[model samples]
Target: MKFSRQILSSSFSLDKVPGWTCPWCDKSAVSGKKDDFRIIESVQSKSQHSHPEWEPFRITGTFCGTLICSDENCGEQVVVSGLMEVEERGWCDEGEYFSSYEEILTPLFFVPAIKLFNIGNNIPIAIKDAILETFSAFWQDLSTAGNKIRKVCELIMNDKKIVKTYIDKNGKRKEYSLHTRIDFFGKLKKGEREQKAYGLLMAIKWIGNSSSHVNNSLTKADIINGLEMLHHILELLYDKDYMRIYKLGREYNKKKGPLKHPLFGTRHL
Candidate 1:
């Protein structure tokens, strides 16, 4: 596969958006890496289909590209795949620009939740696993995506220890397993920390139940609601603490060592 960097940015009517930036011009200096995309290959397909109304023909191609920093000045290359689609406008109709445009994010491919948590690194294994399925759900099956989102919730519950044990009226000890998803929601409704996640988790749980147990076909709205809710929920559970912990680490690292060493082990490095 041929590799190249493509900047992933939200498109607008404005043409020039991160495809390239002026390195030499200080006034327009873009202070980050570029070319984070690698071209898997260029693909094109042309076909004709009968349209009862106005659909005479359609042509579309998707490019799978590996993502890495193309900025030679800054050397950090991590691989992620994003698909961009190009289509032919000459067949049926045309837009203003070159008769075509590149789609940054589409149902055909999944867009990774960005670096708000850790700059595309330090994402948990569970989240990473769910992410692939989430994309698959986006394009292939809404029902399947809802299931994957529930997995993300389960993982979050495990990581956070959402279950609780308590004392009963008879002076007996009791514990809540939260073993099942229903049990998990029960806990969420009761605790302050868990309450923060209550509404979002409820929606996710409902989606899962609707898709899996009820055997109901999910709507695009259902899938989208679950996806967006999980995004924010994960951020609340995992990401909000990032700055707090980083600052604490910085403070702790600033401390100096003791006057004498017993085992000759350094207290701080």
Candidate 2:
């Protein structure tokens, strides 16, 4: 995943550039002006070469093109470079030829394919940095991104405290702190109020452990899936109960005051 340029969401007009996704806006828009695009004619030409099966034939050479976005708000610029080869089914109307030149587009380091989902704007500043860093690593290296996700998992555990209590066989009461992802999920009994989605939590732990091992080569899909799970964890833990819809629901259920609402929808603004 090593690229020549370190393309970022802010470096280019996110929505205007094709093959690019903004990790901030979460919207996808791709369009360019045809009039502003042109081929670099200086570096292109036809050459004659001899092949094993053919006596002699002319082949099209390399050429570069430029595309300028015209979406006044996102007028980004980019260059499309590639080489052309003779195609068997192509033709020239003037000459009786059954072949044509087809240009193969080269690498587009700044295209929209690299776009990532925005983690949203309502999260804590610290967690926001961690989320963005995870994505930033994702674009460069999958393994590195997994490690970043691990960091975010650790941060979540540290920022929130969960208590586990039990009555001992001897009739004594005991309480312990849940300090890790596994611990946080392990402390709860089946169907307990504090229990989170087990599968998602376990996957987070698995991702962290795998990323810590030096021999693992993580995949982009794996990192992204893990990141999405973490996103769910955050949303359920801290991002809910504050939206206007949730607020209205809470007001409508006034009888179920703050403590009685499972979704913490009993609180008022």
Candidate 3:
């Protein structure tokens, strides 16, 4: 297992999405505070199939209960629990998706009541810039690696069997590329899969590229649509994990947080 300091962006908060409520505390949920948790364990095991190895990570952290309200009687408490593992096949050079299990807002929580003057800037400019900048950076960074990224996606789309090779009676050795995608999605043909994969992979590539390379020409509407389409594709492949990570992000402004896992408890952190 390995460890790293992956900063969970503050832009994501559980309370902002739907179905996230602190039952124990019985209050409208608060957003996950920035840098509130830590990853404790990570282990990778190569599958016998051709696909890249699978890396599983375990994380734990505490959520500070300060932003929801400032009651003199309410002592600041913390929420400690295990986190979800954000995984990536090879997208980040690290070959694993970075996860804090939960994303907490970073810059800090805001209290509208305390603002003596409204500068018309609802949120902090630096934080807003950071979110946009980081997202655009991902888009820009992947452009140079676009071909490689697409190839990986294609590999996942193809139908092939995982085979191990050994030399004949003579003492020779052999190696070959085998298909690992089958284990994830069984017996599917390439043509049947390519369009689906293309939709998913290309959406990601285009959206990321436009954000990075197109200046600010991308309107919020465009961004939303592109993201929704990408999310739909990711859902087909990754199902809940993919949608939870991507779609849950934009809903932070909603009245309620994203949906919750039956056993994972409230996602307020």
Q: Which of the numbered candidates is closest to the native, going by highest lDDT?
A: 2
Ranked by lDDT, the better of candidates 1 and 3 is 1
Task: Give me the displacement of residue 138 in model 2, in angstroms.
Answer: 1.6
- Residues 144-248, candidate 1, lDDT per residue (tens digit)? 777887777776666666655678899898864334544666565564435667677777887876777555877877776776676666555556364345544
The C-alpha stretches of model 2 lying farther than 4 A from their native spots are 1-19, 23-71, 74-115, 162-179, 185-194, 241-269
- What are the per-residue Cα lDDT tens digits for candidate 2 across 115-234? 344455566777777877775566556677787887776656555544446688999997643234446555643432235545566687687667878888666557767866776666
Q: Assess candidate 2 and give its lDDT.
A: 0.51
Give the count of colliding residue pairs in each prediction: 3, 9, 12
lDDT of 3: 0.36
Q: TM-scores across all candidates?
A: 0.46, 0.49, 0.25
Using lDDT, rank the candidates from best to worst: 2, 1, 3
- What's model 3's TM-score? 0.25
TM-score of 2: 0.49
lDDT of 3 by residue, 119-178 (tens): 123333443333333333322243432333333333434323334456767878874322
